[model samples]
Target: MASVTDLQYVALAVPDLAAEREFFGQTWGLTEVGEEDGMVYFAAEGMPHPYVIRLRRDDERKTDLVGFSAASREDVDALFEQVKAAGAKIIAEPGPVEGLAGDYGFRFFDPDGRAMEVVTGGAQRAHRTLGKGEAIPVGISHVVFHSPNHPALVEFYQRALGFRLSDWIGDFMGFLRCNSAHHRIAVLPGPPALNHIAFDVASVDELMRGLARMHESGIHLSWGPGRHTAGDNTFCYFITPNGNAVEYTSDLEHVDEATWVPTTYQPGPNTIDQWGTGRIITGNVPHAEMTPDKGLWQVPA
Candidate 1:
């Protein structure tokens, strides 16, 4: 069974549900889809649930990354078995998530402690509702995480979750593809920190408009308006209603089975984003030249 159809929403637990909704609703153009108990869900109107951020924070801006959807129903079942075989404990059975519909899925923890899910209804439901976010900044495009043992964690998802590498950003940052979407998940080798959440815009122009709104609203711009060397997305990063970084991205490259190649590149100021937008020393990231042992594998970085 093949894995990954598209990114289903990466659920985030936010302390202030209303405030988070208000910010993303007004600013990011998300529409509130009511709530369960105290948890509110927002459908990024045009995007699949990929942009829906859940309100269930146990701590400050902490999101347990649940990787997105799988392409086929068989793939979803395959992932469930694969997860168990791969040593991840099942938190939820492969079925409906209670509140969400058309989604037959399950949640499992990856090798590095990241929680992920596999489903079939992911992109389809969002597609039927809003078509595609190509006209607006759709929903969650990717989630980047920082953790130790980049190789083990990345390998776990690739083998168990049906994710493929889109491009390798040095030895530490890897862009992975699930379905036809360019890169749905990216892992930056880490001492462990949650990096950012991304939303796709209709066009690079839409992305810039979102960035401009974020700037006018006084949120800090972390990086972007540059094309990435790995995913080749024209993107901009900013702090969200909560402390987590959020990104508005556009025009990311796509990968197919035919020309799918795992290529490597060296990371530098100019190399991170070829159009020159990604700036800032994110952290103590090991460069490609420095790490002789690492290459593009399903592992973390």
Candidate 2:
């Protein structure tokens, strides 16, 4: 089946663009790649997806788009047909993408009304192997979302995007993978909203190094500096200036697609955070509070 190969970028509209631009470029370790048509793009040092993040000014904070990459224009067209056949609302038909990272793509609204895009043939940026202790994100890791009908939404992604089930945190949360990485997307039961966006760091050492950097920079640690049972990844979660939850994670388990069996872990305090360190700080939960995304059903600019 034609499928999205990886996550490309997440576009966000924040009321305070200046603070967000500074937070991502300076503190979060993404390089400012370009600014075009009032949008600012940021790229990770270790990945070649052009820009992994796009930020724009808006009166209120909301998710603009979550983009995924297709291997070719053929796959893009195939996936577009698949999405449309699944009864998703089409935003735009596949065509040449605009702005700095020019490519062939299409946009649509997911079951929860969040805007999504799949693209191919963008200019690939030259990237180098990030050294140990660099303490920065290597690339975009995974995204988690909250849905009112989580199971149905999970089914939608699987049937439409060619995602496979990785594991489940009981019946409440489901992890889906498109590649060897355990999961590139996960779903939880709640209002239609994003939970968090995670970034891959080099290792557990880098995860700690990043914790220190975030501390020194006065960014509040919302959760973690601990391990999660599902992915076996070390995590350190923080809230961005615009209240979006972001995670710096490392050591995510890679699975063999042919042999791996999905596990349903019982939900508990230790299930989400095995190390128990994240709970040491009072009121730090596994994820942020749930609210419907304000940008739902809005066409991307």
In order, candidate lDDTs are 0.65, 0.92
Per-candidate count of clashing residue pairs (backbone under 3 Å): 16, 0
| Candidate achieving the largest lDDT | 2
Best by TM-score: 2
- The window of 10 residues in a row where model 2 has the poorest summed lDDT is 282-291
- As a TM-score, model 1 comes out at 0.83
User: What RMSD does model 1 have?
Assistant: 6.2
Q: What is the alpha-carbon lDDT for the whole of candidate 1?
A: 0.65
TM-score of each: 0.83, 0.98
lDDT of candidate model 2 versus the reference: 0.92
Per-residue lDDT of candidate 1, residues 115-208 (tens digit) = 6666666433344343342334566777776667776767776877777877776787777777767787777776555677777777877777
Please list the residue runs of candidate 2 whose C-alpha ends up more than 4 Å from where it truly belongs after superposition.
Answer: none
